[model samples]
Target: MRIRPVGRHALLLDCDNPGQVEAWRAELWRRRDDGELTAAEIVPAAATVLLDGVPDPATTAARIAGWTPGPTATTAAVRHVEVPVAYDGEDLPAVARHWGVDVPEVVRRLADTTFRVAFCGFAPGFAYLTGLPERWAVPRLPSPRPRVPAGSVALAGPYAGIYPTASPGGWLLVGRTGLTLFDVHADPPATLTPGTRVRLATA
Candidate 1:
C-alpha cells in the first residue's frame, strides 16, 4: 500500500490490486463509522481510495502507513445481487469469435462466473465489475458507438458492465438485462454499488 497526497485536502491510498482496494475500502468505511478517520468522502477507484476533506494529509498518510492490510473486520454489509440476462445481444457471436468458442460456451462462461463491482464510472450507475478470468479478457471495439442503449451488458478487457443509460460505448455487448440499473426515484439510485457481489444468469 502507498499513500500519496492528491492535493491540499485529499490523500490517495493505492493498493496492490482490486481485492486489496475492496478490503481496504470496507475497512475505511468501518473506521469512518467508528469516528476514527473523519473524512467527508471516501471514494474508491479500481486500485485506489481517495480520502477527501481530510483534516491533515500528512497525519493521515502517516497513520495509514503504519496500518497492516488483511481481512476486513466485518463483512455483514457486503451485498450479493443477481442480474438476469437475455443472452441475445448482437455482439454475442463476435465475442464468441474473439474467444474462439461457440455462442453457447460464451453464455455458459458468463452464467457460471461471479463478479464484483470494483468501481463505477463512464456513466451514472455504470459499474466496472471484475472477476472475468484473464484468459477471457478482451479488448474494446475499435470504434465506439455514437449511442448505446440502456441495459446493454457489455465486456471490455477484464471488466464487464451494463449501460445504465444510453450514451456512447465501445465495449463488446454479450447480453442485456431487463432490470433497471438506475432510478432517480429510488432511495439509492444504483443497484450495483462498489464492493457489491454480482452473478449473471440467463433468463
Candidate 2:
C-alpha cells in the first residue's frame, strides 16, 4: 500500500486492488473505533481509502505503515440487505440470450448469488455490487437512455446496481426493485453502503 497526503486534511491509501482497499478500510474502522485513529470520515473507493478530516496526517500515515490488512475479502459479518426485484425488464430477454439461458434461469441465478457492495457512485445510494459470476458480465448499452427510472436494477460490465433516483444511465436494465435506496430526509440517507452484503429475491 502507498500513502499519499491529500491536501492538509486527508490522506489517501493506494491499495493494490479493490479487495485490498476493503481490507485496509476495515482495519481503519477498527482503529477508529478503538480510538487509535481520528478522522471525520473514512471512505473506500475503487482502489484507495481516503482518511478525511485527519488531525495529524503524519502520525496517521506512520500508524498505517505498521498496520496489516485483516483479510482480502470483506468479512461476512457485514449486514445483509435483501432487495425484492420484479424480473421484468426491457433487457431481460437480451441478457438471457447473452448468457444462453432462459429468463427464469437468469432470475434464479441472481436470486441465488450473494453480492457485496464494493462501492457507491454515479448517483446517491447507487452502489456497485460485486460477486456476479465472471461469465455473467455484460456490456453496457451502446446508447445511454436519456432517463432511467428510479429503482431500476441494472447490470453493466461486471457490476450490478440499482438506480436510486430517476436519471440518465447506460447500464442494461434487468429488473426493478421497490426499495427506497436513497432518502435525503432519512438518517444516514443511503441504504446500500460499501461492504454491505446484498441478496436479490423475486418479488
lDDT scores of the candidates, listed in order = 0.88, 0.89
Top-TM-score candidate index: 2
- State each candidate's clash count: 0, 0
Stretches of candidate 1 above 4 Å error?
A: 73-77
- Pairs that collide in candidate 1 are none
Reference-based TM-score of each model: 0.93, 0.94
lDDT for each residue of candidate 2 in 1-203, tens digit (9 for 90 to 100): 99999999899999898788878888898889889899999988888899999988999899889988776444456788999999898998888999999989988998898998888888889999998878889999999999999999999988999999999999989899999999999977999998888998889
What's model 1's overall lDDT? 0.88
Per-residue lDDT of model 1, residues 1-203, tens digit only = 88899889999998899888987888788788888788999888988999999989899889878776557544466788999999988899988998999999999999988898888888889999999988888899899999998999999999999999998999999888988999988977999988788898888
Q: What's the CA RMSD of model 1 in angstroms?
A: 1.7
Return the TM-score for candidate 1, rounded to 2 decimals. Answer: 0.93
User: What is the Å distance of residue 19 in model 2 from its true position?
Assistant: 1.2
